[model samples]
Target chain A: MSEHHEKPEISPAARRFIIALCVLAAVLVALEFIIHRHAYFTTEGQPLFFAVYGFIAFIVVVAGGVGLRKLVMRDIDYYDQGERDE
Target chain B: MSSLVTLLQIPGLLLVFGAAVVPFLPHKLRQAYMLAIIALSAYWCWGIDVGTHLSTNLAGLDLTLVRAEAITRPFALVFHIAAALNVIYAMHEKSRLTATSGLAYAGAAIAALFAGDFITLFIYWELTAFTSVFLILVSGTPRSFAAAMRYLLMQVSSGVILLAGAVLLWHGGQGLSIQAMQANTLAGGLVLLAFGIKAAFPFLNGWLQDAYPEASVTGTVMLSAFTTKLAIYMLALCFAGTEILIYIGAVMTLFPVFFAVIENDLRRVLAFSLNNQLGFMVVGVGIGTELALNGTVAHAFAHIIYKALLFMSMGAVLYRTGTAKASELGGLWKKMPLTMIFCIIGAVSISSFPLFSGFVTKSLTIGSVAKDGYFVIWMILIFASAGVLEHSGIKIPYFAFFGHDRKFEVKEAPLNMLIAMGIAAGLCIVIGVAPHLLYGLLPYDVKYDVWEAGHVLGEMQLLIFAILAFVFLMVRGWYPPEIDSTVLNTDWFLRRALPRTVNALSRPFLAAWASAVAQSKTAILAVLHTGEETSRKSGLVSGVASTGAAAAIFLAIFALLLLLRFVA
Candidate 1:
């Protein structure tokens, strides 16, 4: 069996945005190797510390929200008992 | 200077009492009058210096009405600026109630800043609540009314709790003067609880997200400036360096990030974002170092301008499009390009991109946490920084202006709103570029180097990579989609659980009361029926004899009594 990855259709502008993002991320990672960051802790001193954390943290926050929605989400008029205005 | 001390009335009285004339003035006159009053109030407030205070005897306790702290200058300055911006942003507003209440609300908050005693502070605290509640009420919807009531309940509860703590302080031989105290003390704990509620600390944060976004288009902007920041000012004054605040602030910083992600309402997302921003200040207060305190003050000042700018842009969008939900708004960049630019500026400023306000100010606090060797908390703060970028920096702009093109046929935001956003954006940039301007007003001298290359590189890497992750998620369809829904928060305890609990608890009592009432009615009717059967006419009245018969009986009784008395 072969695993298939779904690549959603996108506009050209969005595709360009993704490419520009990749370029920027690469530049930042390259700059990290050149610059000496003032790290207060051992983990912070690790190479590409901020870049790794930033990328992972953003993913985690969004993923956690996806899980949270299942538990907490309700209709817009949840509290008003359907007294929402037009 | 001594003679001038006699001339110093309370700083914000001009706006508070002067609001009386607001209702009577015409539109242009009202706007001009409000601006003039704010200018005059700011001028009067400027003359006040620490130790140059006026006191009066109230019920044998001396009350200071015009005391100033070193931190008071910056808070007062930003507050006046916010007030003036409100007047400008509301230039198109014709509702006299919003005008009067807005001015009075701003005035009360400024007054609270200068209060020297708990009693005086409590007065201004409740005044801010009473005046600003109208902003929520002005939305004129059932939800807004409910929100206003809940907002008032929390505000008034804070005031009452503050007073209770003050009385306990006085009872404990501590003067009623507002000063630092041990959080372990009963009075100190009570006071901290009160401040925590207004600061939107953890479970006490419900009212902020609940009420703010529900306010009218411009009203939400006015509502944002005063209340929580006032609580933060008090927290810095009273509870700075408390160890508990460190953990509490950390919790505050992280939880809102997740909630903001899936929230459909853009304004409410900002509210959650505001809560997240506040966590930084709280953490700064917890650190209680010179650098950290300066960071808190500087962050509050910059946060005020940028937050207001962000809210104003959204308000402009709401005003024209008649919706602020992320799911509803899209492709507004062409329609309100100026608003989009202003929103982006606010986003970058909040995201702490280099050369923005957050970079200079938020660094001092995070730097303090790191320097203090709290590695875990520091990491949490860093992660929270990325989370801030996700919601405020990218999501707000992406969904509202760039994502799904709803093709809203809306015009540009009003001229006055543009001017307000322009001025606020200009301030954010000025403070960001030359942080020394804001630093000079801080309580302590700043030693933190915000622009160090090493720090700058780290910050840029953090922010840029965060954006990359956002783009990555979007392209892959891994990001959570905004849907119209109610996201349960701590407010669920107040809005849902509390009411449901009350109804559940009262059910038995209500049922028993109903049964008792029915039994009483039956017993009364039975007595009446028994009397009616005997008399045939009706109850007790029918048992009475005719007039002549009654007179004869009375005479017989009187004669018998007379004979008995003679025999005795």
Candidate 2:
């Protein structure tokens, strides 16, 4: 089933968007050193504080969410079965 | 002053009852009439004087029906505007019930906002719940009907708790005023719980995620605009500065990020995102400072528009394609470029990207929390902002429009829907660019600069890094693939566990009761048979002799009585 459908190619416009986004992220990271931040706490003043925090947080949330699936994920008909019996 | 008082407009009445006349109008006239009602209501709300008016003494308590303050004005305005847009979007829906109920729902929310006393607020609050359920049921799916039932139970429970809280408050000598009160007391705690339920706070949040996605395409868009925002208005009005709300808000912000990640339904993902957005406003209300409250109002204003836009795009997708599940959709952007663009705008606005509506409004809450030295909470909020970017900002558009192409060919959204989305999308950008337009409506004076270099840079770093993280995950196959499935949440307890538990607990009891009823029925029938037999045995003799014998006995007695009376 997976082999039957050809993998869709990324369009030129989408490719440009991805490239531009990568470049923009790199530029923004460099600006963290040049820009003066009015940091609220001592740790936030560190270089790349937001970048590091945001990246780690995103991974943690995603990984945590996947783990949660182990606990809460059920067959799509989980509720539907109950409704039928009801 | 007397003449001015008499001239005061009750937009709530106009919206609520005026919608009842919609079915009487011809088909073409209905749309014009609906739009006219909304416009007139908007005009009425805008012209409302900045004071409590329409006070009446009822049952020895003063009830103020219209309280137009700066804090509530923005919420009411956005609700009216969103409702009008909803009317436009649904102009082609052909269901008078949807149109009428939608109008009444909006009217109830607006009325609840302007309510000066708990009694008035509770009336409109329950009205919203009662009327909005029709929108959900209008979807006409069995699942939607079930979801609507659950939604109504939850909502009406909130209203009942609110009424109980009001009664308690009145007994506590607080009078039925709708003002900030300490949550330490029983009454205050009950009221807070009520608002918490409607606000979709944590465990109480299941109804929103369960029902919003189950509503009709346009119904979801309408549902997105009201119920929860009304609770936010109430929170800002009464529960500000309450320490518990800050923690609650923070948790509200964080938990949905996880559920939204692997959720299959795109609309459900937006529902989760809506919960996250509400978290921001809750924090602002918790802070209760001028700036924080202002942030709450501005964020609510911005959220109503952009969230509606996001829901509209998904609705259009669902309208065109038969499903909104991410697993079933991809590469629709080529066919529905306009919807794609509108969805991306909504995504960016919600992501707090620079020059988007979220960037300006959400910062105020974050800034206030940081200033107040809630270092840990501020960090959590910042983290949740990134989480928002992942689920709502990237995941939604990626799977729905740009991921592995399923090669679906569908026309763009209908013209009225595009018009509605365009208007909402336009507002998102406008608010993002000229936030002062929103800021001016705040209850407090504006002093915070949203365009400061530090704030903007920090925001950009957080958002951009989050985007990179998404890219890395997608490229490395670390991202969870969307599957056709439902992820259980707190609603599982009510929808499945509670019913099964009840069934388990009641089966034996019900059997015993049924047996007992059968036994009792047999005993009663036996007794009735015995009585009938006794009566039958005596019936012939009594029937034959009764009339003539009774008359003779009566005459003899009467003669004896007459003789006795003469002797006396």
For lDDT, the strongest prediction is 1
Model 1 misplaced regions, further than 4 Å = A1-8, A82-86, B1-8, B528-568
Per-residue alpha-carbon lDDT of candidate 2 for residues B440-478, written as tens digits (9 for 90 to 100): 888898899888887799899888888878776765557
Write down the C-alpha DockQ for each prediction. Answer: 0.53, 0.45
Which parts of model 2 are misplaced by more than 4 Å?
A1-15, B1-8, B511-568
lDDT of 1 by residue, B366-445 (tens): 99999999988999999999999999999999888998899899899999999999999999899999999999989888
TM-score for chain A, prediction 1:
0.79
DockQ of 2: 0.45
Error of 1 at A35 (Å): 1.0
How much lDDT does each candidate structure score? 0.91, 0.89
Positional deviation of residue B551's Cα in model 2 after best superposition, in angstroms: 33
Model 1 CAPRI rating: medium
Q: What is the lDDT of residue B300 in candidate 1?
A: 94
